[model samples]
Target: MSNNDFEKVIITIKVRGSNEEYDFEVDSKVTVEELLFKFNEFLSIHKSSVKENQRYIVMVETKHDFIDPTLTIEEAGLWEGSILILTPV
Candidate 1:
């Protein structure tokens, strides 16, 4: 693991069908899939009603492109204030 592995960034989370947005401080080393799971759990904890969409397309929202689940946040080129979305697939 490199120094960037421990880099921390603040990112915004957007879930489809829900008007709410969440901000999370996370390590850049975490994989996209892991972030998705974390957000899913967070959604359940905050507002259980917002988990209507089981299948979602997670992406770096500002980029408007679907991100690979296996790639780490840094590897995906995401930076501070990036919006990660769990949009309907």
Candidate 2:
């Protein structure tokens, strides 16, 4: 595969019920767990209540679809400039 297949892409992550939107760079090889960890870190930094213990789900805004936490970015069909919504489970 070409390097572009592993290239990092910029995506927007918006937490539902909040005015916060975070721009994150992620490679297509990244897994959903890795993405969640990043979100958890962001929450911790912002002092948000949605930490690691809080059960939450990530969905693709374009498709209104829930992403499998075990899937890789590519497997999840996430491309550059994708917007994901974070909602409580």
Candidate 3:
């Protein structure tokens, strides 16, 4: 198949304020916004009892490039092992 999406990718995420890092396995076709939403949901569930009304932007940790939330992981040129930083917008 020519599609690269549908496959799993391991993304390492670092929140802007905190030094703690998290790794997630997500579908390559998922949009950046969706991933952020999921990550936020995860945080709300594990760390706190209530969800925060916050928005985030994803960035390439090494390159310092801001990724568009509308773009899919593959479209963003993210590979199997990608490091990302989440910053509040």
lDDT of each: 0.79, 0.83, 0.83
Task: Answer with 1 or 2, whichever has the higher lDDT.
Answer: 2
Q: How many backbone clashes does candidate 3 have?
A: 0
- 41-61 per-residue lDDT for model 3 (tens digits): 888888874349578778898
* Prediction 1 global C-alpha lDDT: 0.79
TM-score preference between candidates 2 and 3, better one: 3
- The per-candidate count of clashes, in order, stands at 0, 0, 0
What lDDT is reached at residue 39 by model 1? 76
Q: Which residue runs of candidate 2 sit more than 4 Å off their true CA positions?
A: 1-5, 48-52
TM-score head-to-head 1 vs 3, winner: 3
Best by TM-score: 3
Estimate the TM-score for candidate 1: 0.81
Error of 1 at 1 (Å): 10
TM-score of each: 0.81, 0.83, 0.86
